[model samples]
Target: MTNMTFSEQIWYGLFKPSKYKELVESRKSRSVLYILVILLVLGLVTFVVPTAAIITGFGGMNKLFSETMAPVAYDGNQLTIEEPFRMNVADTVFILDSTYYTVPDKELERDGTYIAVGSKNVRMTTIIGGEKWMDNITPIEQVLAPGFSNDSLVDMVPAIYVSLFLCYLIMCLLYFVKYGFLALILSFIINSMNKQMEIGLSFGQVYMVCFYGMSLGMLLTNFNIAMGLISPMLVSTVTVFVSMNFITMAMVSMRKGNQV
Candidate 1:
């Protein structure tokens, strides 16, 4: 090996992954921990604020959904969710073809399709069917675009859009740093099954485990922030049962897959 400066050597080796257990437990890895905290705060704040505002502004939007709409089967795209509770959910307003925003860099709309005008302290807008509507409130979800609501992406306004992008990028990057190739593969498998995963899923099936774990937690997120973090741990309690029998079950499952 040719002699190189410490910086040069460290730069080249940076691309290579270090041992997992080491990094996983390193106190120096607080960047990812901080990122998780920021994203959680951003997501929870974004969700609760607009939800609270919508409830305050339109009053019944939350009740309408939790009491009425939720009871209806959710067909997702087939349904146009115009409730006040989800004004921050993307595609629920405005119009974007993208599935979801990149977390920290959610692009609202551009050009004439969706535009913003005037000074209600607003900066985004759009024109459709000869009618002009403004929408700058970047959605937490962006599905039912083109309609305006009391939950317009403009509520708390700038703080939501700008901060969300930063928080989202950090969360995504941190997700990659924490979840390696095996976790990625497992995630894909879990994503294939259902909307969420529980904690007791197999190590090979950690995807589903984490998915539903997050999902269940998302629902109860209205609870205290600290509790919200711990709530997902409930899935871990189920791990003992899964471990007791899953090894033999996994071997049999693999044999069955091999036969196919």
Candidate 2:
């Protein structure tokens, strides 16, 4: 195990759970920390392309607004635009028509539906469960804060990036908590069963085994998320199942003295 390169360690961690016994016995305690850091870094890497696309999308929207949007003003009561504006991006339609007080029924039936800015309020319509759902009408004055203008949209780009970073941090924290909880549970189970064999593994050692065993599951979870292939709950369930299976195999190998 000491002779194994990092890539070989990862390969064994994913494909050969029996090798985890050697990892648990021969590796330093910090090996678990190293695995955790690697997993977290992989998680962060999965978000890079999506985050970049979001920022670029915002930039494009700002450019579109700057170039095409007419000068608009809002008083305490009504919103006034120099001309009625309408734009459709993909399936969603944005309309700034002061004459219409509500989103038209036809617009609400489409996939992405409509967000209509009327003189007094903004109305949004969404389709859920094959039914049209109208969002609460927001007053124009409430929607447009005082001193807020279209120019402020560009200023929000930095804040958007900051928000994305915070979200990524929060996600990493959740992953850490989730993985730790799984490791603790597996360690307890392994220790309880080990009483029969008298293998005498400590909680920390079992935890290290479990963490190392989780390599493949974590990678698959990240891949599924990046590809948007499954629901979050399904992905989580599969990860838990895979990690537990790998950890069980590792514990069995440890008991058999196969790879120690």
Candidate 3:
């Protein structure tokens, strides 16, 4: 810690957690730096990586939408699709008119996303992702000639970007809260062990170690996922146990036989 810079300590904490005691002793600023670096790493792994994958997988969603989804004529009162078509749910848009009707697209019912045009109240259902959103649409001020407009599909990019960003931000905060809570519990255990060993380390020091220790657990969980060795349902539980174990190992390595 005396010789290493703040950025160096961050790398050390991730790869060499045994140096945590020395790192924690130098300056409280190290704690803040470590936290910011950890969060940045987590954000890159969880958000940035997935976002890149999605962008690559879609291969220009706007272009795809423009080429595919187009408005088709339907009864003003109702639009029904009984067959699967290339222009399925994502491409289908029901234009609102004087007639209030029901849409029953068998293809959409099986798997698709349908949009009700000219109304703020719209039902968006995705069969594959198993997500449903209902809202009164208020954006379209005029009724078009009762057909799908590729421009409408292309125009949705900004809203989708905003929604995705908000969701990512919320998820990051939730993860921080969850990880911090678990780290605090692990810190309590380390504090008790410190007392037993006659070590004088404070709870703050142990808590910082717990947070840094979490990086190892997060990395391991990511590795296990990439290797397809663990199920998504078990990741949180496994992460907690793994992170706690890392903290325990750090405590033992950093202080042995009353050496703090």
Clashes of each: 27, 0, 10
**Compared with the true structure, what per-residue lDDT tens digits does model 3 show for residues 1-63?**
267877778786776666777866768876877776666566556665666565555565586
Question: Which residue pairs overlap in candidate 2's backbone?
Answer: none
Q: How do the candidates rank by TM-score, highest first?
A: 3, 2, 1
Which candidate number would show the highest TM-score if scored against the true structure?
Answer: 3
lDDT per residue for candidate 1 within 30-126, as digits (tens), equals: 3244334434644555444544555465545444334533222223222233331123331123232222222111333322333211111113454
| Candidate 2 local Cα displacement, residue 199, angstroms | 2.8
Ranking by lDDT: 2, 3, 1
Question: Which 10 consecutive positions of candidate 3 have the poorest summed lDDT?
Answer: 83-92
lDDT (CA) per prediction: 0.35, 0.69, 0.59
Cα displacement (Å) at residue 126, model 2: 18
Q: Which is the better candidate, 1 or 2, if ranked by lDDT?
A: 2
Q: In model 1, what is the error at residue 89, expressed in angstroms?
A: 15
Tell how far residue 244 is off in model 2, in angstroms.
Answer: 3.0
Model 1 / residue 221 / CA error / Å: 12
